[model samples]
Each structure stands twice: as structure tokens, then as C-alpha cells.
Target: MAVFEGTFAGDVSNLKIAIVIGRFNDLVTDKLISGCQDCLKRHGINIEPNNGQVDYVWVPGSYEIAMVARQLALTGGYNAIICLGAVIRGQTPHFDYVSSEAAKGVAAASFQTGVPVIFGVLTVDTMQQALERAGIKSNLGWNYALNALEMASLMQQIQNTSSSPSAANLPPGNETIALPKVTT
Candidate 1:
């Protein structure tokens, strides 16, 4: 049997990546950006502001991340996208709405465009938890970057693979089954 999978191992110098950040929670999102940049830089991807291989896009808040991400993905300019934001629970239900919608949007963008969109938003109960996850304890941005790399590599492999083999090339005892034709 043949198996296919993605890994965090690849030459990232030629990969084009984009990061979408929400300014609503800059305090925590900034750290996530830092961790993400560190991971990309370590993998040999240039991290310069504009001319670098990685491009950064800023949105008003997490709620807008999905729209921008979908637009970018539609451009076919980036191999993968990373979205970072923080939506802390508040007295109202605003947190739930924003976080849930952001996640769904990010997912929809990837599904519709066939691009790897990494959702790095943090939905925490408190500022302390957000800070800890952003950088104090660990940085999820780094992991998100790694995911982008692996997914991009895998996508490249999938796209570059040869087309399906013909029935004549099938191994013995594995003949192709013919479907009956129906006339409407």
C-alpha cells in the first residue's frame, strides 16, 4: 500500500507565506507574530517587512481575518496563510461570536480556495491565559508556522504527482470494474 503525508521538513526559502494579524488584541497577537516569525526565520524564510518571502497583513479585529484571508488565498500569491488573534471572554457574548465566526471563516477560506490557512486565534477566559499561551508559557504561533510549512510541502507533492494510472497498468487480480451505462 502507498501512503502520503506531510512533514515539517522542506526547503522553505522559496515558499511564500502570509500572516494575517488582528489588532484588537495586539498585546497577545504581537507575541504570536514574534513566535511565528522566529519559526519561519529559523527555517530559512526571509522575514523582512515587504520584500521578504513572508508578507504581513493587519486587520481591525479577528472578525475580519477570514475575509482578508479569503481574498489573499484567492489571489494565488501565497502557498499558505497564518492567522493570529486573541478573543478573550468578556461579560457579554461578544467573545463567543467573534471567536466562533473567525474559526469558521478561516476554515471556509481554506476549503474554498484549496490553500492551507492556519488559524492561530486564541479564545481564552482571561488576559492571563491569553498571555501565557501567546508567549509566557508557550507560543502557538510557532506551531502554526510549522503547520503551514508541512501543509505547503504536502500540497506541492500532491499537485506534482503524476495522474492516475490506466487500467492496463493495474496489478494482477486488481482489475478495474466497469460500470453499466444507463440511458435516461
Candidate 2:
């Protein structure tokens, strides 16, 4: 019998990530973005797009994040995509519609593209609540960023491991080849 499992190393220095930010609530979204960047940097991952390590995309609102994320994922330009936004419940039912769609869409993008699409969007009852999560009290963006990195790394590790057969099953010089690297 054989069992396979992955460990959470969380080392993301060698991976690429994307942050899809919504501009509707720029005040809160900006803070979330900052927290995410700081977290990634502390984890030894650079957020400099010029270095081909991280990329950032701005959209009108939460409702628009998934399409852009899907596009980025399809292009194979990122190992993981983090969607950041703040959806504060309003007087109307607009909040419910938008928030649910955003979550559903982002999830769909992940499923359709086979890429890790991290949902960092915040759906809160008030502006204060959104601020609290963004940075005031608990910085969830930091956690989301870390999660994306961990998931991407783990997935890659699993793919690498499964490509090779056990030592006893090898025949001649034929060896397993690793998956192709994603191109920008």
C-alpha cells in the first residue's frame, strides 16, 4: 500500500501570483492590497511585476473581478490569483446580488481554469467592518495571500511527485518529464 500527502511549506519565492483589486471601495481595497503585499514580501515573495513575480489588475467593482481573473488564469500568467474587494451591505438588495455573484464567479474561474483563484473579497454589513478586516483589527488579506501561495506551492509539488513512478517501476532510461513552466 502507498499513501501520498503534501506538506505545508508555504515557500512562494519561486512562484507567480496576481492580485485583482476592485476600485468600487478603493479606500478599503487599498488597505487590503497593502496587507497582501506586505504578507507576500515577508514570505520571501516579491510583488514586483517587472520581475515577473507578481501582477496587479484593477477593475470597476467586485462584480468585474472574476472575468479579469478568469482571463488572467486562462493566459497561464499566474499560478494563483487573489481577488480583493469590499462589498458593504447597502439599503437596497444590490449588496446581496453583487456579493453572491462575485463569489460564484471567482469560484467558477478557478474551476474552469484549473488555477488557484483566492477569494479575498470582503462582504461586510458596514464600512467599519470592512475596514476592520482589511487592517484595523484583523488583516484577512494577509491570510488570503498566504493561502494562495501555499495552495499554489502544494499543487505544484503534487503535480511534480505524481509525474514520476516509484523507483521499482522504472524501465531503462525513460524518465518522467515535469509539467511545462507557465509563460508570461
Best by TM-score: 1
Residues 1-184 of candidate 2: C-alpha lDDT, one tens digit per residue: 3445433355556688999999999999999998999988887887787887988899999999999999998887787899999999999999999999999999999888778899999999999999999999988889889888777876676566656567337677845444334554
Candidate-wise lDDT, in order: 0.86, 0.85
Candidate 2 wrongly placed segments (more than 4 Å): 1-11, 166-184
Per-structure clash totals for the candidates: 0, 0
Candidate 1 total steric clashes: 0
lDDT, residue 42, model 1 = 88
Q: Looking at model 2, which ten-residue stretch has the lowest summed lDDT?
A: 1-10
Q: RMSD in angstroms, candidate 2?
A: 4.7
